[model samples]
Target: MYVRSQSDDIYGDVWTEEKAYCVEVEVHRVQDAEDLLFSPWREVSWTEKKREELRENLTLYKPSFEALSKVRVLLLGPVGAGKSSFINSIRSVLYRRVSLLPIIGSVSEGFTKKLKCYDIRAEKGGQPTALTLCDAMGFGDSEGTGMTLHDTLAVIKGHVPEGHKFQSEASINFNTPGYRQSPAMEDTVHCAVFVLDACKVLSYSENLEKKLKKLHRMISDLGIPHVVLLTHVDQVCHAVQEDVQYVYTSRIVQERMQKAAELVGLPLSFVYPIKNYASEVSVNCNTDILLLSAVNQILQAIDDASEDYPSAPQEAETKR
Candidate 1:
């Protein structure tokens, strides 16, 4: 909330006798809906041409069959970590909001509110396989203790098998039989997109590192390369002289961040950061670009998903 005095509102006219010099600059109040999901408001002379041009080059993500069909990403995070919201953000990114309605009563909203997958091809669109970006139930260890960890894990696991490498003792359960899904309104989350709130309290919370490490180990063993989404970074990095790129100053924050990364184990590289809101316009953030800093990392994983396809691959003509 920035305040301006009445006098400051009016600009000084510098000896304007030739032409009437009246250039008005105003501040208008707008809501989160009006503002682009990942855009920061800035000042500019109102010109229709400029507006249209800006829209053309904008890298906005709107949910649409076109974009959705091209890739499949699974949203994974601790409970209340904004998994659903991020899924919505993806819809926004691909410009397919209208087409992406939560198929009413399809997934039993009261029991399991899942958006039906979009088959870009069926609608005279491109691909045959519909893209599935899953929003997995959060693994927050239950804000409620009455709920035992085992039952919660059962639901959270949601068809994602416990790979043989990690939980060797427990039988593998909760796997969506690889590809070729059933016709009965199925939503399979391929390739988990795990979220970590950048603003969450850092420092010692015993076993957090261990839990995160286990999660990472599981991800690696599952043979699914993942995208690490570190969100709400603006709240953590705003006040400091250090930029969002350097939010790891505090040793405590860094340690926790490291733990999150380590979870993915060796071979995987990099963590991505995003400022969740466009309340303020700054070079450090882009309100119109949900996690722009992390987009490259995400696309990399998406492109790599070809490796995980369940179908047998062509034997690259074995030359004698």
Candidate 2:
């Protein structure tokens, strides 16, 4: 059952033939649970004579000029927990179509958001994408420099317990290519977003858990694709913790953030609750539900890395 209809505007389809997806997927358990069987209004193949030209083109697609740019996102947080106001609220809400994307890497004029990177491109063909928004200067608000904790224990000793070190690894090279001087921080980071601030841990009664296990061992080497962006969540759902008891310190910081994502294995990762584009009379510059839950967690990471994004089994209208 598939009914087709679109009246113009897939948002400048970029080059026309249209194709932009970025689903990496490696939960092994659950952070998404197949996002309700994939639902972005599903259906986007269009071929039967363009189904009468896709109902005239279909509002030129607009998820705020969309740009997951193929998952390379590294928006680690701590400093003011806003990350340059969520990259200036996605370029002032798509202003200049994501600041005319050549790779959005030049927002910090002074306040340390250095080593900038947005570099995203692809609509009709696809290839150029970087997306490195490392606001790690205030590493957990202490102002450290780059990835610390001995660079996350030299990449978690080559992924702990992943097959007993693959039979001794012969010598210890592990695809070495000049490590990380600036080859763009040794790339390959699909998603490590963790910007939680929920009112500074809802006043912390006792849920820091050794500072979230030292920021989860300094970003758990992106283990199991961590993605917790719980910014403010509009003051944790419009404030009412047992009539102001403060919901038992936000439920012990959500059971120590779900036991630090199950001791870094990941039975739960992708959490969303954001609010803060800006303008709540700037006490410290807030706006929350975690900035629209970090804009719906990067549009669900561009709809789980879209491959033209569609898969509800098939039901545009029961396909006529």
Candidate 3:
């Protein structure tokens, strides 16, 4: 029997007949065991510098043609999917503080009743982002309760003006006030984002899915770019709920993204997982990174679409 010393390495010490038979051996491990409950945290290649670079890229984004000054992305989703909350999330990052604008909260029905366009401005009062986010009323479970197909088409064609209230009784017509008789590329939607709740993905209503499919077909016919924003990611995946950095490694999160792609008929790359500022009163870096990543992809798609504009050739030369 031997006395334990403070300088002794408990795991490295070997026992003999003369010493205490507390046989100990050091085991060198190359990697950790796989966690069945949660995925291990993996480092993302993008750093704060990369995020800032993307933000600067967006700030200086220019359309191939001079007719358009900004890329407009229209947000479409059912009530409670956090469309307004998503807008607030992005604004929070840009302002470097919590933003409660666009007035988002829980309710029996959608709170936004008008076609509102939001612009992002730098915290230090520099040039605003070249992207415009258009927020429309949430789609309802029943007919004549929320945004109608006619209203969506009007907006897609750049006919619906900012602040035009949606009338459940009927659709906007040619005689509607503030209607643009001849809408230009700048006034039209460059990309469409369908916001969905990751928690409700496995249990999405058939009616809502059908409506989304129909809208997808219409948007496809117009050759407009579209994507899906899978929100509430934190509520779905346990690992992500614990720490959002594990989002990319979690199998559950990957499955939800796959489901979103299947539902919207979009590629997996076009589906983004995001967590909005629903219950949080302050801004968070993890949340901001997710929102900005989605925004950056949408901006790239908008830029691609702008390059293929049929009228760009003549319009570009005419301007010169």
Best by lDDT: 3
Ranking by lDDT: 3, 1, 2
For candidate 3, give the lDDT: 0.77
Q: What's the C-alpha lDDT at position 113 in model 3?
A: 85
CA lDDT for candidate 1: 0.40
Between candidates 1 and 3, the one scoring higher on TM-score is 3
Best by TM-score: 3
TM-score (all chains, Cα) for each model: 0.48, 0.24, 0.82
Cα TM-score of candidate 3: 0.82
When summed lDDT is taken over every stretch of 10 residues in candidate 3, the lowest stretch is 30-39
- Per-model RMSD to reference: 12.2, 24.5, 6.6
Model 3 Cα lDDT, one tens digit per residue, 1-320? 34453334545544333344345656786332232234333345446776676656666777655667777889998888888888888888777678767467678688888999988766646667778888999887655668887788789878889999998896888889999877777788888999988888888777777778888988877767899999988887666776677778877777888988887888888898898877677866777777788888898787776666565322333344
Q: What TM-score does candidate 2 get on C-alpha atoms?
A: 0.24
In model 2, the number of clashes is 36
